[model samples]
Target: MKAGFVIEEHVVVYCDGCGDHYSEKDNESICFHSIAQAIAYFSAHSATVGWVYDGDRILCDGCIATLHCLQYGHTYPDTWQTTVWPLGKLTRSRSCAECGIPEIEAQS
Candidate 1:
């Protein structure tokens, strides 16, 4: 848990750019680390919720899913992108486990 370490005052998390959360190892690649923590945190917090990233500091589980899709790819009802903003809108709920894209009306 917590990036192979313990949670403490020094263990900084939460990326403001995309709201992706991660542990602080006192380095530059904060996004990748935070993405890892986001995944675990959401998994424990929400069985259906997961985390993704956008190459910057963003700890939001919603962001994580988007990141996953960016690096990989995603699919949906086709009309899904109509309501949400690109890279900002997360899977409404549990997305295709493979794509990580949320259902049009689901919550990530």
Candidate 2:
């Protein structure tokens, strides 16, 4: 008779931004049995998933968005021009800011 030991493998994903592992509510790290499974899961849940695997690195949603904004440009609320109407209405507008983007806001 031959005796053999069984070994299990798990893949732990980490966020490049915060240097934290993907975790559940109980703080348990989310692990996958294989790299293919990890990639498939992330790809399938990309929209609702809070983290992203951006080819070279894994990043939290906020970090990825911030990186994109830094590379392209983003709008700031403080940069928006706001006006208040006598009827208690508010309007804000910013055209072609540093990001070359236009924005408008209307409130009542």
Candidate 3:
């Protein structure tokens, strides 16, 4: 009896500034049953986390939550902003189903 569907998600994070991407290259990308679990993972590793939508990129649930927190005056730990530029903003635009991050309109 299959009551629910099993979703296999592969989340990837890319640093828009440096073009560095993180994924399952060596099993580093974590797996979760729900978006909450994914958000927890990012909260734990927010230090090196980034939020952006390049091309055909599916943001992990955590990325969206982190961005939302930042936009809503949520302060991050010192380590989270360690490498961040003195006056650099997190990202230009993005969107999330769970969070209220603004969505970027597609250009014609």
Candidate 4:
């Protein structure tokens, strides 16, 4: 005799800002067993991870940072200081003029 089983459907939440979803496995979007589960998960992790989950919309960390920079603008210096590594890799560093945020970028 064959056994019977049930397959259930779940909801997947996506970020409103970038259209990306959270994934615990890092391979695919997370599937919540129910809407309550999704809400609970987001409520627990959102604030700590810089995610915005306001029931209707979700925003990830990168999107939040980008939005902040766009609204206020980055105050990087006019010229970035460049450094050359032994292996010929080049990097540039600068501090924002307004907020004094340090930024580093690698050049290819």
Order of the predicted models by TM-score, top scorer first: 4, 2, 1, 3
Is candidate 2 or 4 superior in TM-score?
A: 4
Candidate 1 wrongly placed segments (more than 4 Å) = 1-13, 20-58, 78-108
Cα error, residue 21 of model 1, in Å, equals 8.5
Residue 5 C-alpha lDDT in model 2: 84
RMSD to the hidden true structure, all candidates: 13.6, 8.9, 15.5, 5.8
Writing each residue's lDDT as its tens digit, candidate 1 over 34-73 gives 5356545544654343333334533455565566678877
Between prediction 1 and prediction 3, the one with superior lDDT is 1
Tens digit of per-residue lDDT, candidate 2, span 14-69 = 78897877775787888899988988888888678778876777787667666777
User: What value of lDDT does candidate 1 attain over all alpha carbons?
Assistant: 0.50
lDDT of 2 at 74: 78
Tens-place lDDT per residue, model 3, 1-108, is 546887556544444444445454473754466655555655666556444343434354456566667677543222221223346534233444445445433322
Per-candidate total of colliding backbone pairs: 19, 0, 0, 0
* Candidate 3 accuracy as TM-score: 0.24
- TM-score winner between candidates 1 and 4: 4
Model 1's C-alpha root-mean-square deviation from the true structure amounts to 13.6
Q: CA lDDT, every prediction?
A: 0.50, 0.76, 0.48, 0.80
Instruction: List, residue by residue over 19-106, the lDDT tens digit for candidate 4.
Output: 8777756548888899899888889988776677787878877677777777899877789899999999999999866445689999
